[model samples]
Target: MAKKGHSEEQILRALRQAEGGTRVADICREHGISEATYYIWKKKYSGLGLSELRELRQLREENSKLKHLVADLSLDRHILQEIVQNKAVRPRHRRELGRWTQAVFALSTRRVSGLMMLNRATMNYQSRRDPQHALRTRMRELAASRVRFGYRRLTVMLRREGWKVNAKRIYRLYTEDGLAVRTKVRKKIARRARVPALRATRPNERWSMDFVAARLIDGRWFRVLTVVDQFTRECVLLLADSSLTGQKVASALSQVIAERGAPMSITVDNGIEFASKAMDAWAYQYGVQLNFIRPGRPVENGYIESFNGRLRDECLNVEVFFALIDVRDKLERWRRDYNQVRPHGALSDSAPAVFAAQWTDTAVPGPEPVPDRTGKPAAGNSLEILT
Candidate 1:
């Protein structure tokens, strides 16, 4: 016989009839059900009224839906935990995680995207842009050659070489290609307020000088005397020797003066070479004022100090010197590159020489001075004082 479907009302009515003194076998026969089915229904619905039976069926349906909801939530929690473990923050990383989730959990893209909080379209996106293999290769070569250069400087260099690229694009490619330069974080010091150094308004108006020391391969120490034009940010002199005395320092200054004319003033720290009588005689002869910073205060001559730090970081620290000649050769080459090729941020991302040339091209000439009645140059009319 085929199985019969019984509603809650019909089953309750049959059970009530059996409970009202009708024989269970007669009820089973009349209902076309076996005696066993009648007993089971009577045991389950014997005391329940129609209202209570309806409530029971409704509760069973609600419980099934609740179980399904809990299962879905658990699966979602599992996927979220996996994502968190992977620490996926970038969209590209999240997209990769979504694919892994789909493959591992046998889930659809829609489900994985929902759980990962990523867009379905983004997860499925494919780039149509060029791979830029040549650009990346060139960038890597530049980075390798100038290991201390950042993406901004590299972008400037690339533009100079005819590449139409922006800093943002280069930075993205820099990170993607792992060409980032690592820098050390210096310790910060808290100090009282200080008087700011005077800014330079014209080339050769002011110059700053400092010394940096490094060791040779044979464990002998040598010193480099660096002189920079404050206005142009140009390295005027980079003299390297085993020992730089006051006479040697004066000679170097004279050499620079012969080439670029004399600066109005020179800023230097209170070192022995700077304070020597030879340096004093040289300054007096040139009529150039020597501005000596206070003892233990290097910030008073901040320009040369900044340049020295860069020289130490980029050139000295990276090179090995076997002899004094070797040191001089390396210093000279680096000084040329620094002045003519390397981009300086203070120069608007232009090389120092390039910026100086541009300034020279745009600068207007001053008016001629009036003649004096004494048939002699007026006092304070000399270029030394006027500068």
Candidate 2:
């Protein structure tokens, strides 16, 4: 970076233009250099004349040469320290100038060897063995076995195996094997824009309906058909039984319509139950739109999905069902509380019933309460047929 290979004059001129507020992109294109390269030159020659830049290069060259000399001095210091610590001086040196002849000064290798009374070959000896050769092998084995183990973990593993290796050495071998851990790449799911989840502009403008299931004491599974008003977050209806037929669904919807009128459109998934002849007939009869979401995408019907989650978590998960009667009673109580007591965050922390009440005049009349069962069960005896 210090020697960019371009003339100093060219670099200083680019810096001047950059300081004058021209954009970096324009400067890079005009100069045929990368943005990074331009920044590097700009930083080095900022507010300096060409002559000053030349002087700085010369000074840097001198500093590097001085560093080299200091390194040589450090090597000489270590040789003297080793000789005194070992006390390995020959008796010939002791006979002559005592330790002076044994001292290792910064002389030629041959002269230093003669002065210390050691062989010249020993003074010029070099270590050709690579200390990390075994370490690299072990690191490769660990990497092949455990792909997730990074350099730090490999360091700990190596130390436990009685090898004296550090994290820095392992990292060097790790890169030598091209073994950097791969980053997870997120795939973009192929999403074609469907119409957004329809937000109801007003009460009864849109409705989200879905089915949830639970079991009775006899281990008989029952389905709960839930209908929610999207605008007010209101639970308009909950019908639970051993089975819900398409005709029964139509009848329940008819009752809601008779009371509160009909929604502008009903949002549902493409289930067989929602696509039944009875449902289609009912929609045509009441002039209501049946908006079915695409198959396999439940989030399109999120409002009902959220309601179903709360119902299961709070009611079904807690209660032990004894019979259809118990489920019915608990469901009735919970549904009432959900509409009248529980404050919905979407409705400004107001209960769904409270929020709906403000626009009751606009909403169709709600269903009339059915008479209490003091006598025998209704025809078919299933909870779905009762109402």
Candidate 3:
């Protein structure tokens, strides 16, 4: 309701006139006020001068301001209490607090949001996203089967199975579902200056050979001879036996050579099997050079070393072999998967077999020869190595 516009001085003067024997009806008519309003004003502000009236008005305004301040402080205290009780940090949690505040404090959404320092939109949000029950179920299945696969690799696998998904989405769901794999932290080593190894420009241009060992469930140990093509990152051969001699290694190489042709050179560590006479004879027969790395320098044969590490990590470490037959069967299956299914980051996330099939062996020029001490080109082939 609109208030009457009688100034404090006017009201006080009217009351003084009434007190000084003026008729109430006459006073009301002069001021254009009802007699009831005059009496109410007199009852409220009787016996006061203009200065005292102004002071009372000022004090009333100050008291009203203090009441507003107290109400705001009470609201802030309630918000702080809610924050402490819930310890809400995430937006979802804060939204819950907003609901509680609205119910408890009888506040509107805007007021509660303002008090809680939360976004009104966030408080009103309801997720319309799919639960992805099928996707999550399939992802959990894959993770359970392949315990070492990370979200990135899992994304590749999901794509292969015709899922239209990306790694970022998969990673979000992967972490939410707690399917992340724990990785081991390796000790950092002091790097030293060393000669680089030769990079293979085409499949079968160069091969790396190495041996890995594993124990069967019966506690009987077996050795696996791993041969990898450096260019394609393909596992050329995986031979597992109770024991592998130099002759066995040579035989395995001969079989691989029969199928895929002989490489120009083979990089191998200075292991007994690789350095034996049988291996040398086999290399001589195939007219392939044997580039034996320095003793204890496994990095020189990095391709096979990396392949061996994966073999142990993904297959050997996870499986328990019962017999030589079981070992061979498991190794064969894993080798096929490694070549055809698993994604290689260095191969642009392509499988070894797929990358090899897509590769075009364009001729790249060889590196220039290193100069001698006299600044003249050396006579022999240049030493080009892979980093």
Candidate 4:
């Protein structure tokens, strides 16, 4: 009824007329169209009315304008903002970019740095920092435990436990917080010469012994027979008293053998007590080789000699024994503690007992290479003489 491809409103109006019993041919002719066109319009726009078409057209026009207006407005705002921000920090532009003005004001006086060395220059400024309440508590705990750790060591410890920090930072914090260790710096004593080369890697391979003398409270002299495991630095045997004869020494050694087993070789200084026939017979019976140091050369038997020095410094200097019984008791306690608790730097801070446990026994030579009378290498002579 409507023109070809007619508007939805016109088509709907035509369909309404047809439903009211108007002839399809008459409706088509009234609309300047054909009968087939009227029927097609009726079928397509039977439900849609004139008001719905007007509403949809108005909505589409309004939506299109809204999109175009939003796009133009956004572009204008971005250009204006960029131009304003790019302006110099002059009095006129400062008001528009207030935050930038503040930043310029703060850093304007700072000099341009070309070769600034931080921490060693005038510009090195320290900011006020909040103290770590947790680290202070931990340091106090370590101190109470008598662990004796320095700031660097403490920093390492904290790092091991997942705390992020630097040693110098920790040290500064320590001094400021009064958590630094207040220890008396004793004079650095010269290190003693190292023990002679025994190179005993196996247990019961080489045993070295020496005598250490000390005075009791009554001024009575007492002697300590100190024997050590050369590879381990373990104080295997310690006997107290000067009345110990060669026979007594033998008996004491026999007792040690009964407990810890006999060594393959026993080395000692050429003392009368050790060189006697009684000692020689004991060595033979026990299948232990007896090696004596060169006469007038105490360093040749240095393993036991070094042990004596340590024993005096750690134990003998700590107390005044009133009697042999007191000396014996103290010696026993010291030996156990030394073997189990005291850390040996030579053994990488492990106790002798711990070191011994970790050691894999190997057959070490009898001694280092000893020179012959003509200053030539002695045949199969393992003892070395340091001239």
- Per-residue lDDT of candidate 2, residues 67-87 (tens digit): 998986676566556656657
Candidate 3: pairs in clash: 197-385, 197-386
Worst 10 residues of 1 by lDDT: 377-386
Query: Could you tell which candidate, 1 or 4, scores higher by lDDT?
Result: 1
Q: How far is 341's C-alpha from truth in model 4 (Å)?
A: 1.1
Q: What lDDT would candidate 2 get against the real structure?
A: 0.74
Model 1 earns a TM-score of 0.70
Off by over 4 Å in 2: 1-194, 359-387
Model 2 residue pairs with clashes: 259-365, 260-364, 260-365
Residues 160-256 of candidate 1 have per-residue lDDT tens digits of 9899999999998999888888898889999889788788777778889999999999999999999999988999999998889999999989887
| Candidate 1 ranges with C-alpha deviation above 4 Å | 1-88, 96-115, 188-192, 367-387
* Candidate 3: tens digits of C-alpha lDDT, residues 1-387: 112476787888898898899999999999898877887888778988888877877797789899999998988796778668878787866887888888877879998777777789999999799989999999999999888889999998899899999999998799878887888898999999986776886676788888899999989899998999899999999999988999999998888877777777889888899889998888777767889888888877778878888898899999989999999999999999999989998998999999987764333335795554335443222432333
TM, every model: 0.70, 0.44, 0.64, 0.48
Compare the candidates by TM-score and give the number of the best one.
1
By TM-score: ranked, best first: 1, 3, 4, 2
Overall local distance difference test of candidate 3: 0.84
Against the true structure, whose lDDT is highest?
1
Q: Residue 207 deviation, candidate 4, in Å?
A: 0.8
Clashing pairs in 4: 1-38, 367-382, 368-382, 368-383, 368-384, 369-383, 369-384, 370-383
Candidate 1 vs candidate 2: which has greater TM-score? 1
Scanning candidate 4 in windows of ten residues, the lowest lDDT window is 109-118
